[model samples]
Target: MRILVTGGAGFIGSHLTDAFLSRGDEVAVLDDLSTGRPGRLDPRVAVHQVSVTDAAALAAVVDAVRPELICHLAAQIDVRASVEDPAADARTNVIGTINVLEAARAGGARVLFASTGGALYGMDAAIPSAEDQFPEPEAPYGTAKYCAEQYIGLANRLHGTAHSVLRLGNVYGPRQDPAGEAGVVAIFCGKVSRGEQPVIYGDGGQTRDYVHVGDVADAFLAAADAPRPGVWNIGTGAETSILTLADVIGQVSGRPVEPGFGPARPGELRRSALDVTRAAGELGWKAATSLEEGVASVYAWVLAGEPDR
Candidate 1:
């Protein structure tokens, strides 16, 4: 299969691109380099330095690639930044998704959107939220992703396209940017490597379903092989508190590391996890990497000076 992965030079996208290439699929990438780095991708992969927000250029790439499947991973993923400037976030996460859907439609390609399970469900949501739960996003980033998902469903209904949405958990692993607002695992690992105390927000009791990027890449592959259009929660169905995560990092670092506490940021979920039973039944996908193992990988990557590829 011919696949085009937008933001394929980023952390999870880069890993997903590798998965496709490993299976003997021809893959291409579309990234703006604002956050994605070209060095993360394989040298043989053709990367189009185009942002999904640019409809014309994205459409041109889509036309040229004529991919059978498009994994849309490009977006403004920062929740705090979304709260600061919602319009900018919408331009990237919302409007950018529409542009990808349009390009896919023109080329008769199917789309696999990278939606957010961590941010979409609100603070009051169930411990393990399902696909049927009402989305009560606290920030523009989640709202934009949810809105983009609606467009995907609409496209499916109107055009009979089998585009799918994968509501993802908090993905983290090697190649993740430690400086980013997301990927607490990467951030904490970086802090541990530099001998800095990890900062805990709101007593560190807040929890999330931290899924590994490699497992997330596997989920994408499974969804790509499935012959249908539907939303699936890709997660471990387990909630790990921030405090517990810090403990895991300390254990992986092989040292005693204390943490500092700070006031909780606004528009953040208190506790969230996705019920991935549907994904298991439908896509044959489940997160296989344990938190300890995943954290160790990130720590090792950080120790290696955080190589791009």
Candidate 2:
């Protein structure tokens, strides 16, 4: 199949691109490299340095590729940045996704959208959020992602476009940029490896679901192959606090990570985890990598000079 992966140079998207290529699919990567590093992408993949918000350019690429599958991963992916600049977030996440959907509809391609579970559900959804739960998003980032999900739903309903929206948890692994807003695991591991103290906002008790990038790539592949279009959570259905996560990273990196607590970020959620039963049942996907194992793998990757681990 011919596939077009938006944001294909990014952390998760790059891995997904590799997975698709490994399966012998012809893959075209469309990425602006704003936050994603071009060097991280494989040289064999056909890459276009373009932003998703450029509708004309995006449509032209889609027309040229005529992809059977469109894995849409491009977005403005920072909750804090969303708070600071809501318009930019909306333009990228919401408008950019619309452009992708339009291009998919025009090209007669299926879409696999990478949505966010941590941001979409906000603070209170359930211990493990089910797909049916209404998103009480507290930040513009979440709201924009939810908006994109809704637009995809509409495209599926109105245009007969097969689509799957994977609401992802905090995905971390090799090639994940430590500087990104959602890359807590990478940040902790990077700092610990440098023998620097990792700072924790909000007393280090905030909990999150940390899924491995490999598992996330698998889920996307499964979603692309599913017979029906739907939404699914891609997570381990487990929660780990920041404090515990820091300790785990410290242990993995062979460093002492004494976290210094500070005031929580303005729109940070205290706890968030996803219920992945639907994903397992529908997509036959589960996060096989444990938190400790995932952290250790990431630490090892960093130590190995960012090999394709």
Candidate 3:
């Protein structure tokens, strides 16, 4: 199989790229290198420094690559940043996705979109949210992603494409930037490495579905090989509280963690987790890494000086 992963040099994307490479697939990357690093990818894969918002360039690259599948992972991923500047978020998250879809259409490639699970579900949604739940996103980032998902469905209907959506949980693993806004696990590991306590906002009661990057990569692989188009949530289907996350990291790192509680961020979800039964039955995929094992991997990576590969 020939695959092109947009943002393939980033943390999760790089891991997914490696998974494809290990399976003897020819893989390439299209990334702006703004937050993604080429050093994280296998040298055998070619890297194209193109932003997804540039439709013509993306189409040209897709035409040249002629991939069987295009894994669209590039986006404006920061929720807070999206809240502050919604138009900017839509430019990258929404417009960029449309550009990718159009490029895929011209290049005769199927698409697999990466979406968010926790952010897409509203607070009123049942815990361990299902795919059928109506989305009431609190931030513009989720809204933009949902809009992009709409485009994916539209492409499938109008063009008869087999594009799919993977609604992801909180992904954490090596190659994740510790200072980044979304990676709280990596951030906590960085703090523990510096002999500092992790900070817990909102009384340490807020919870999220934490999924490992390796498992997430596997989920993408399964989705790519599946014969039909569908929407699935990739997660453990269990909620881990911020306080418990701190404890797990401490246990993994051989350090005692003491978290300082701060005022909860306004409009934060009290609880969120995905109901991934649909993915399990349809895609034959399930998250395998536990919180302890996942945190241990991050801690070990941190201790190893956070190598790119």
Candidate 4:
């Protein structure tokens, strides 16, 4: 099978690309290098430097590659940034996804959209959000992702495509850059490695469903092979607080971490985890990486000069 992964040079995308390649599928990448890195990609994969917002260029590439599946991962991922500039976020997350869908339509390809879990659920959502829960997103990033999912649903309905959405938890692993808009795991690893204290926003009590990038890659692969087209949340179905995460990183680093406090960023969820029962039942996918083990990998990666590939 030939596969094209947009943003395939980034953290989660890079790992997903490797999963496909290891399975003997021909793989290509489309990344603008805005926040992605070429060094993260394998030499065997063909790399295209283009943004999904450019519809014509995206369509041309899709037509040329003619992949059997397109895993859509390119998006504006920052929640606080989205609050500051929603239109830009929508342009990339919403419009960019539309371009991918249209491009996929031209070649009769399936799409697997990467969506957010906690951000999409917002404050009023159930403790462990299920696929049926309504999303009252606090930021444009989540709203745009949900809107993009809607477009995918529409495509499936109007054009009879098998496009699906995978709402991911807070994904972290080796390739996630510490300096970029990384998750708490990478950031904490960077801080601890540098002998600096990680600053926790709010009271250090906010919680999230932390899932490893490798597990996320597996979830996508499972979704790709599944016969049904639907939405699934890829997470561990467990919540770990910021304070606990800091301690976990400290434990992994063989040192005690003392974190500083700061005001919580707007649009941040207090406590969120995904009820992944559906994913397990439907796709036979579940996160296998324990938080401690996952944190150790990041800590090791940070100590190793953060290699790109």
Which structure is stronger by TM-score: 2 or 4?
4
Better of 1 and 4 by lDDT: 1
Q: In candidate 2, residue 86 scores what lDDT?
A: 94
TM-score of 4: 0.99
Instruction: After the best TM-score superposition of candidate 3, give how far the Cα of residue 212 lies from its true spot, in angstroms.
Output: 0.5
TM-score of 3: 0.98
User: What is the lDDT for 309 in model 3?
Assistant: 85
- After superposing candidate 2 on the true structure, give the runs of residues whose Cα lies further than 4 Å from its correct spot: 307-309
Question: What's the TM-score of each model vs. the native?
Answer: 0.99, 0.97, 0.98, 0.99
Clashing pairs in 3: none
Error of 1 at 16 (Å): 0.5
Off by over 4 Å in 4: none
lDDT of each: 0.94, 0.89, 0.94, 0.93
Instruction: Candidate 3: list runs displaced more than 4 Å.
Output: none
lDDT for 245 (candidate 3): 94
Query: Could you tell me how far off, in angstroms, the CA of residue 197 lies in candidate 1 after the best superposition?
Result: 1.4
Backbone collision tally, model 3: 0
268-302, model 4: which lDDT tens digit per residue? 88989999999999999989999989999999999
Expressed as tens digits, the lDDT of each residue in 1-309 for candidate 1 is 999999999888999999999999999999998889989989999999999999999999999999999999999988999999999999999899999999999999999999999999887788799999999999998999999999999999999999999999999999998877788899999999998888887999999999999999999999999989989999899999999999999999997768999999988999999999999999888899999999999999999999997
lDDT of candidate 3 over 63-133, digit per residue (tens) = 99999999999988988798889999999999999999999998899999999998899779998999999
Q: What lDDT is reached at residue 246 by model 1?
A: 90
